[model samples]
Target chain A: MNDKITTPQTIVLIITTLIGVWITTLPATLAEKSGPDSWLMVIIGGGISVLGAAIVTSTGRQFPEKTFIEYSVETLGVFGHLFNLGLIIYLVILTGMVVRIFGEVIKVFLLDRTPIEVIILTMLALCVYLTRHGIEPIARTAEVLLPILMLPVIIIYLMIILFNGDLSNFMPFLRLDFKEIIAGTKATVVSFLGFEVLLLFIPLMQNPHQSTYSSFVAILMVSILYLFVVVTVIAVLGIVETSLLIWPGISVLRMTETAGTVFPRMDVVILSLWSIAGFTTISPMLFASAFGISRILKAREFKSFIVPLVPVAYMIAMFPKDVLEARKAVEAVSNMGLFYIFVVPLLILTAHWIRRRVLNR
Target chain B: MKGKVFILTVLIGASIFFHGCWNMMDLEKKTFIMMMGIDALPEGQQDKIKVTLTMPVPRQLVGAEGGGGPRPETPQQILQSTGNTVYGTIRQITNRLSRQLYFEHMTAIVIGEEAAKGGLDRFLDVFQRNKDFLRMAKLYICEGKAEDVLKMETEMEPLVVTYINQIVHFNSSRSLRAINYSIGKVITELHETNGNSLVMRIRPEKKEAVVAGSAVIKNWKLVGWLSDRETRGILWMLKEINRISVETSIELQTPQKGLVVLDLVNFTNKTKAKIQDGMPVFYINMRGEARIVEKEERIIKKEENLERYEKPIEQAITKEINNALQKVQDEYRVDVVNFGEHLRKYHPDYWETVKEKWDLMFPHVKVVLNVDVKIRRQGIFK
Candidate 1:
């Protein structure tokens, strides 16, 4: 407990802790149910996920010295270990799927000639190496690259504002019925799902008590940014164009005309920076998988596990034949795999709450 | 060290794949569209839509500021094509070009005055649909040859798009008139329930096609055009007085009448939907600051002129605005000002009961115009 184990800087940890999980399939899954209103789902989904985050934050505070893996075993015993393994397995698959999604995006949008396996393999290879470095380096990388990722986002917003942002795009507000909104919210709440990953890092943080607050702030900021992007894309591109286009963000990248400048195509700078953030996002998932497996195997250190798993992931990513199938597979992961994020966080809180009540009696 | 080497290798591999591909739109081979004009071909030519695209010839030198000089003598080279549809015309024109045209660089789109008056819905349909066109690009309805306005030279900007962009700049900065009439706003209005719209009117002023005013649209077609003065008046009603000066002359103490200009620096207009005597009534509340730019008579105290000038300018501005509003409502019968939308947003439920009958109720609906036009500052040493 007293050891100086390397952990993330508070801000980057908070951010990477959220984006590490959410960003990949959200743009695609939100598109599934609502078509254009998919962004609305991201916003609604973010809000619902906040509730899960609050519970995890409170529950993690109970065993400040323990990770969710340790605390779950303590709370639920041998059966709990089995349940924790199941959750870890779901998260590992999520890690695999994220590698597949980002690789597919790179293959389709950025590099058409490049094979999807080559792309996913390369990204997974990086992820395995970074995981071996431990969580602190991942957070440091996020800290360094987040600002660069933000510049293009700010530029896109200003471009929309200067050119004319159609407020009417959001008008006819609440166009979807309450039932659909609720359903959409359920599906999307997972888009904001990564906040619950805080439980896994409880032991790593120097101060677990207040980490939840940072998690909440990260969720709020991400939601706002998600809404900003969703609204901006829908406003400019309209519903039809937005639906068919593979990457809505890059389209906004291409839309901007640098008035009175030599440089015309600015999406290049944006794609390059976003790929770095993608690295931060993917590495954490792979790290989480390796770490979880280390505890399960009773290995000496989680770092030892990353090397062998890299090729396994690379081979798994190859299963998705192409970009379209890979994207569809990621969406399915978010849709079904979201239950893994939600159920575990909810169980810890409810179980903890009931335990507190019985103890009081 | 193995981890570092493997990680570097992966990053390099990924970079080689993504390498400079997403943002690549080569400028050298791309045609920079200067001006675009949309028109329905002449009578009996129902199958054809006329398009005039003005492109920069590179050698043509034009500038923006040279004291309103005569129209440049050079014959403006414009490519004209006719096709059954807007996309058809675009495709037809593309065949004539050596390079691909980039709609991203285009600044102004002009629909001829006749095409605007006839029906702009069919004409602007493609611009709204096309992926190539820019959202913020200015759209116009021309007074004459759709190509003539584009042919007009400027003293500063080397291209027509750059020139038209400058003329329309004054509108957006002040936040007047449908947030300065971008293509996206026009498209949005066409689709909105209340259906409010504006298209910048283009006419040859000096050597260039300066933005004349604005044309209002109802449901998707252009209903009426506004002169710059009338347009400013309409903008004031819509509460879009960004930083425009409203100048009118009147005698000061029986001295020779001088131009009294009120430079509206800022404004916020709120229109409300209310049931007054079982009738749907709209109340427009306007808050703005006016600055006196210039005057000819031996001026009284700048503060003293505030009282003397307030009532008349307000009345005059109000009268002009009412005329514009009436023309839009009573004659043209369009709610291009978005007074209806303001109500729909603020009072959505209340609007629902009246939504079905808003058309009949609108023209007769009592509009309570309450203006708080404040004179904040006067011109120095006038």
Candidate 2:
């Protein structure tokens, strides 16, 4: 928390955070709803999330060095305290949902028989360790690991295309009706939920005014990456097959073979890399929650909130009994996140505007 | 610093105690199932599927030139068990085999005609559900028991799985003798299409296995078979023909008017569906480039003769494709050539109305085939 993050670090953090478990599951969900037009839905969804990120970053920019909790209180007076509490609750729940999903995906792909608690705990422990150092260390960590995480993913997608991808899977483009297209876009928008973490981290940026630009650039990069992944999965596995898979991204990588390499399977390498990406996502969420709590209580030290919040996050993550339940819980959290992204930011901005007018008058 | 070290030590200790290492097995102790075979259970047996696993011996894969007493006999072991489900059957076999059975390297799965006839939907459930099994494994339908194909002793390669993989992958590029259908493709065809598709048919000879033709599966049940020539025509329509030679004879007013061979260099097919006279009409355009490989009747090595060669080649392809289309559309009554897929994609509104009766309408749909062949080059001297 002592050091300040630059706009590039913010952009890197936004990109990595935006692509968590969604990288594995979004294509299938989109395929289920939009058919081959899932690629179109990705574009629409990314555009919607870019607007969401703009709203979030702009709200943060209004409050100089203050995060969401402090800014909301200054804008709305006593009611802003309730708003801050709601955001804190939202971040904690979002963190818990992410932990559950990250653990569930790793369990399904890599460790079949591992206890779900251990998986969640291992990830939570890393998040706790990272968040204790605050936003600066997290941003720096993201800056260093972004390429390491993204290179393999890009290579995996490129390999699928070069090997034997059939573009016909993406054919019959724009075939979905208006209703289905909107529904598909909604599913894709859920994957872009993690980008809203910008609202909390923007305060830590060295140049807060540049946060909005960095957020848009980060979201655009993530959107293009997601577009490639969704199109690649559809092209390689076809629409119906992609829909049938629980994790089409991992399944698509499993379909490809790198002949000379001794690594028997590429999916293992991808899973390992994806688990690291999941670390970036979960750590930011934990930081947001702990940061929100520290800001509201006016505590000078935020590290104390990290440990006590672990048990709470661990409890919330273990709330879901199975993967299906975990997904439903994550969907609920994502819907709440959507509200915070669109409604909360706009609400705070409007409040600030009204207060400024009254004070000027 | 003291508290940080204490916490770090405790975290490492807890990780060692609670990590996911229980399911770990050494590479030496585990056995990889290179290929699997599913067959119908014996009469009076309660089980539904008899699973056959082909496992390669690591000791035999090592070069046998030096430090080898006699080249290791039986480079692979074929194990079988009967159970109601594929996973259940594998678990049953695991009890009989000393080593743990793993399927990460499984490259192919051969389904017996009997088992395929029983309905492939049920047999494919485990392949789709299991995370360990790869969806990229090539699928083959055997005329007899799949176990026979998996258990065959190969003359060239030591392992039957490698031998089968070579036949499927190599022949797919060289000729249209075998159709390459993976589990992913089959699943997509079954789920997305009208559940009518073709799987490469494999038959075992005494010392070798012949992979050719295709087994037609409709509604996930074995419907019939397509010959090698028929498969070539189907491949041509599907635009999957990699390299194939077509030989056809022409009647000319000459003493030695005879056959001409053309090696297909490139291929492309376009199928469009439209309403003609209030019925679905499929217009298929098949364009190909070929080189004159062999010719019996030698006209002067002129350009007109090469142009004249194209007409006879197109006619020959059209005739073969017509026969194949007739058998698949009229005789077998299956839309395995992706005609329904075209209708569903292009004419969605019409597809909605007739999709239910597609099985009835498929045989009656007027499919017009237009073949265009260009002789790109005529060898060194024509």
Fnat of each prediction, in sequence = 0.07, 0.59
Clashing pairs in 1: A45-A188, A45-A189, B63-B155, B63-B156, B64-B155, B64-B156, B64-B157, B174-B242, B176-B240
TM-score against native, each model = 0.73, 0.92
- Clashing residue pairs, backbone N/CA/C < 3 A, model 2: none
Q: Give the CA lDDT, 0 to 100, for residue B86 in model 1.
A: 74
**Candidate 1 — what's its lDDT?**
0.65
Q: Which parts of model 2 have CA positions greater than 4 angstroms off? A: A257-264, A359-361, B1-24, B61-72, B241-256, B296-304
Candidate 2 lDDT, tens digit per residue, A130-210? 888878888889988999998988886777775657776776767778899778988988999887667677778899999
Model 2: per-residue Cα lDDT over B346-381, one tens digit each: 777777888898898888888788989887887887
Model 2, CA-based lDDT: 0.82
Candidate 2: share of reference interface contacts reproduced? 0.59
Q: State each model's TM-score restricted to chain B.
A: 0.82, 0.87
For candidate 1, lDDT tens digit of each residue in A287-342? 77777778776676898878777776676666677767765666666654465556
Q: What is the DockQ of each candidate?
A: 0.14, 0.47
Considering the two chains of model 1, state its CAPRI-style docking category: incorrect
